[model samples]
Target: MLEDKKDGWKAAIALAPAMIFLVVFMFFPLVNTTIMSFMEGFQFRANAGIFAISHRYQGIGFQEYINVLRDPIFLTALKNTMVMVVISVPISVILGLLVSVCLNNIKRLQNIFQTIFFLPYVTNTIALGMVFKVMFSTNNGLINLIVETFGGDKIAWLTDATTKGYWSALFVITCYTVWSGLAFKILVFLSGLQSIDKQYYEAARIDGASRARVFWKITVPLLSPMIAYITITSFIGAFKAYESVIAVFGRGSYIFGPAGDTNMWITVVGYVYKLLPSLMTPGNLSKASAGSVILLLIILAFTGIQLYVSKKRVHY
Candidate 1:
């Protein structure tokens, strides 16, 4: 018992630094944010290199959450984020699976192909967004040039607000998101595919299984765990998309409609970012915190659902 106690003490000592870091950084912030979410009109005061809530406007209620849910801008951001998550995640997963399967089959120059595909994953997101913006520019973009070469009129790929009454910007953003997210999914799927038993494929081949059947029956079921993981993570990432919007459309840029009214291509994170400045005052701090809490809950709920579904569907 004394030896076990000594070992336990050593283990605790070893973990002390990491535990302190998490408490100071992650846990504290999460707790503070949750507390702020329930508060209204709370102000922050800085003192001696630390910040504390001022008691001037302490309101403990759900009004902030109600306001967040009712605010049109927040609602729009929620809709856009949902649309992005729904559209981009499935497309990315499908493309990743297909490409990974192809890559798995190609033995010659496999490393080179893997490197080329993974380049996007390592590339700077802002730089890639800039490149995409340039390519989709309405005035002198490569896409417009190609269209002009084919005797077609220039199309406003990024700047278009309403084609008939729908937000065209959503489509552009969705496409960009799917393209950007492909590399990571492909890498994970390829790794999972390689780890799968080759004997399964051999058995399928001996049974005269067609390529499609073999993939559906053997590869997909075996790859279900990776698929579930990728899907959950991709969905969360898509829901929090903000950088691409900032890169393609400058910060605070808006999509102008035919009636001259404007709509910002803001995601949930973007909405929170916009609201963060208001936290300096007693006006919107609680509201911003409420939005953040909503976002956190959404991510948690989705993750839980994915986990539950995976338990039923995933094989090992």
Candidate 2:
């Protein structure tokens, strides 16, 4: 009993630093944000004489949520984030899986190929976004050049924020998002593929299974765990999509295609950031906090659904 108690104490002591960090950084902030989300009007007053501080808010309810929901920009951010999550996650996963399978099949220069594909994962997002922006720019862009060569009209890609330009911009952003996300997905899938036992493949081959059959049956079943992990992570990453927007659209006047007449794109995170500068506006901070809370609930819902589905679909 004494030895076990000593071991337990040592383990707890080892974990103390991490526990402190999580309490200070994660749990406290999460609780604070949740409370702040409901503030109608918040103010802090400090009294030095008695060393006392006081804070007050008018009331607490769903009003902040309603305010954020009523804002057209917040609705637009929701729409954009949903589109991003729906489109980018699947495309990135499928493409990464396909590329990983191809790399697994080949023996020659496989490492080199993987290194090349993973280069974009480590590369600077802002720099890569700039390159993609240049490729699709309205004037003298490579895409426009190709269109001209094919006797097609030069489409405005990144310039105009009108409906037409919005589609073009969305296409570029989606393409960049899909491409940028592939490297890490591929690396993960490749690692999963390598860990799969060769005996399974050999048995399938002995059973005269076709490549397609082996892939669908043996490979996919074994990789379901990794696939689920990647899909969940990708959805979360896509929802918090401010960096990609900033990278591709340039934080200039045309950013996120502004949820307005320009019909530009902006994620919920970007909208929250746009709110920060005007925090002086009554209830604005609460609205931003409400948006964050909504985002948190959405992510939790997605993860829950994925986990539930994965219980049936994923093979260990």
Candidate 3:
């Protein structure tokens, strides 16, 4: 009994550091942020040119939520986030699945191709965003240079919303997102593909099943579990896809747009960044906190719906 107690304590001691780290770096900060969202204004502010501190909780009503909903910027951010979720998730998953299957069929250089596909995932986002910004620049960008070299006019990739140039920027952003996101999905699909019984495919082939028919009838159903996982994760990732965009695009001038032409393309994280600066100001702090809470709830609702739907669809 004493030995068992000592072993348990040793195990707990092994876990203690991680537990402490989580509490300090994650849980405590999360709790503080949540509580801060409920409180009014900043923790410290200047009143009549004198420094002051207020700890009072405020803005606890429908009005807080109404205020958030009423803001056009917030609405645009929400719409943009949803659009990103819609666009990026499907494309990335499909592309990842395709790449995974292709890799599965390849006998040699499989690792090389898979590594190439995954390279972008490990590359620094800030560096990649900077590189992409230059490549997609309106003038003298490599993309425009290529187009012009082929006797095409030098097209504006950014800062021109007219004639769908704004969409060009969006496409550029989405392309990189898809590129960066594919690695994880590919890994997932590969794992799923590997786990599937080889005898199943052999059995289908002996039954005169074509490749497409076999894939649809055999591979896809078995891949559902990983597909479901990718779906949920991709949905969540859409909310976070703004990091690269923000790095490439300047802050808040075009702030998710080519001058109000393409409104509401910002992700939820971008919206939070918009409010983050208000943390130092007591007046705006509460409202910002409210915004934070709303964003959290929105994300929670989206993920919950996805999980419930996927659970219903997943066949054991």
**Candidate 2 ranges beyond 4 A from true positions:** 43-56, 252-254, 258-263, 278-283
Pairs with backbone N, CA or C atoms under 3 Å apart (clashes), candidate 2:
256-265, 257-264
| CA lDDT of every candidate | 0.79, 0.83, 0.74
Candidate 3 residue-wise lDDT, 23-65, digit = tens = 8888776676666665544454435331122344444445555
Cα error of candidate 1 at position 165, Å: 8.7
Taking the tens digit of each residue's C-alpha lDDT, what string does model 2 give over 41-154?
A: 544445523111135667878898998899999999999889888888888899999999999999999989998999889999999988987888778889899999999998
Q: Which stretches of candidate 1 lie over 4 Å from their true place?
A: 48-55, 163-167, 251-262, 278-283
Q: Would you list the rank order by lDDT, best first? A: 2, 1, 3
Q: Worst ten-residue run, lDDT, model 1?
A: 252-261
Question: Per-residue lDDT for 219 in model 1?
Answer: 96
Best-to-worst order by TM-score is: 2, 1, 3
How does model 1 fare in lDDT?
A: 0.79
> What global local distance difference test value does model 3 have?
0.74
> Pairing residues by index, what is the TM-score of model 3?
0.84
Which pairs clash inside model 3?
A: 37-289, 41-282, 41-286, 42-282, 80-264
Give TM-scores for every candidate, taking all chains together and pairing residue i with residue i. Answer: 0.90, 0.90, 0.84
Q: Which candidate, 1 or 2, has the higher lDDT?
A: 2
